[model samples]
Target: MAEQCKISAAIVAEEKSCVLKLDGYSRAKGLLKNGEFIISALFNVGGHDWAVKYYPNGIKDHADSISLFLLLESAHAKDVKAKFKFNVLNKNGEPVSSYERSDWGSREFVKKADLEESAHLRDDCLTIRCDVTVIHGKEETRVPPSDLHRQLGDLLENKDAADLTFQVGGQSFSAHRCVLAARSSVFKAELLGAMKESSAGSIEICDMEADVFKSLLHFIYTDSVPLLEIASNKGETDVVMAGHLLVAADRYNIGRLKQICEEKLCTHIDSNMVATNLSLAEQHGFSRLKEACLQFLVSPSNLEAMMASDGYEHLKSSCPSVLKELIARILPAEYKAAKDIILAI
Candidate 1:
């Protein structure tokens, strides 16, 4: 029972003829209705929750997550700023997370304790209220410095996570899981029921490095994931984080996160570690990773190109059979024969 928040949209073209696709139950006292979006604040009041708040018998006016993302992405690169923020709350009308307009801000994470505050206690619902801003029409908008879109585009274009176990600071990770989780929602929407329908129960991620796993968990809940780089010296620019994230993304069928991982991988294609991982990408059905692996294997010079490429370290220990199969797939049909001949000679 709060008043409507009458915040304004900066885009001049949207000043008129905009519909308030606003969900009445939204806690934001005033969520402005405009083109492609009705302004919503992340602060959730107890009354209206989005997770189960269904639209009246299917009126498709308010945008779905993909539509909003597309509308945002379609903005000219220079017009898009590198930052976004939201003000979120839980059921008890307490601060779940919030942010004001800033040049660069990521989605705030809600902790388990915060969940306790949810008025409705829906696992997927969060009390959210906040305005979004786009820096379009400027001489140059602040897009991320790294090329996330390109890496993902390469993988999707080719098909797959580009399967490489990203080792950052010496810790190994599964690239496939990361990409899938990141881009999962997109897949859920686009594929129209292809995602692995979660069983009518909960899921707990298996054994994972605690902090890294937590970071990934955050990514699962919120599409906005913070970038963490493991070994910049060896050219692992967020590969560990991005690689693991891709696997999670793929698992959840989130498309954008997968693309972000692929883009990150493409940025450092020349690095031996990346090439080796790309080789492993195929087993996971990461067509792009498979393709990258094929490209590197084509150049014997690249395979001969080893700078501490402990190629099979993680899998040989944990998944010997799977790794062996991958090796067989990677090597030529005559590779075993050639090895036997060399031993005899």
Candidate 2:
């Protein structure tokens, strides 16, 4: 027998959508007569030009209704078949299925009287969404996922084209000044702006550990923190590392990383770590984290346990005002009044 081979092909439909928001619908109705239309701005979909025609008083025959039509505007385009749907959007900007119309070209979309009374028309405005799916008689090709971050991370790991070095906690770290400057305003000012470190070959970073700096560099290169991911599986270490990363992020003016660290610390609050987290929050003026810490301290048992924790004394000495705020948060009005009177005496 002869060997046989078969080829496979699949049809693909590329979909795109545009929304036409008709503001001042009542004004449009007053300005445009029946059969007259307002054409939407030309939009491109699947390599073909398209536009929507909105008739305020409807086309000639359907005078009582609002009309919508999707027109293929490419001048020389031929044999381009597409499926389209016109949807009347509700008050919350959601499509109402009852008002949906699917067609090849024109549609008398909604009755003007009905639409005027419905929630779909609000603030003298109405929104219509048109979805077009262009069919192609060819197989779709697979597109690979983006690896830009991976490539950048590889560059960092290989230390290729490094222009600056940081001496942090007695350890040396190589980095690209452009990359650091691009990621952080503080780094940008220090490395590129009129600062002393801008001209220095090696800069010393104080009050930050080498490991924390390493993790920060990873985030700068790859926009990720594998250290934080790994730390999440472990308990106390995760909270402690997140707190450290939060401070480092704030110092470097890395807003997203700081938010991520703050969120992580907020979720990981326990009696043992609450005092330390509270102190950090107070010093950094992190309102959300401070609120989370105070909420954790609302329980009498948690408060007692936090008072006996290792960080309690540090929290007291470093942020006495925060402790006073904590007392006000957990105390009743009458008791607070009594305490205030006693202090006055």
TM-score against truth, every candidate: 0.35, 0.58
TM-score of 2: 0.58
Q: Cα deviation in Å at residue 189, candidate 1?
A: 14
lDDT per residue (tens digit) for residues 1-345 in model 2: 001111111122243777777777877788788987777777778788888788788987889988888889899999997778887876666777546677855546777876765556778878888888787776366575666776798688779999889999999999999999999999999999999999888999888999899989989998887566545445687688889999999999999999999999999899999999999999999999999999999899999999999999999999988887777777787797865754454
Separate clash counts for every candidate: 64, 0
Please write out the lDDT profile of model 1 over residues 1-345, one tens digit for every residue: 223423232211222111112334344322322222233222211111111111211124322111121123232333234233333433444333221122222211222232232332344333343333433345363475554543453354343634433343345443344454344565334233444422212223454454565555445444455444223333455566566766766765656667777666655565456445654464466777655655654555664553346663553454454334444555677699754444454
Tell me the alpha-carbon RMSD of every candidate: 17.8, 20.2
Best by TM-score: 2
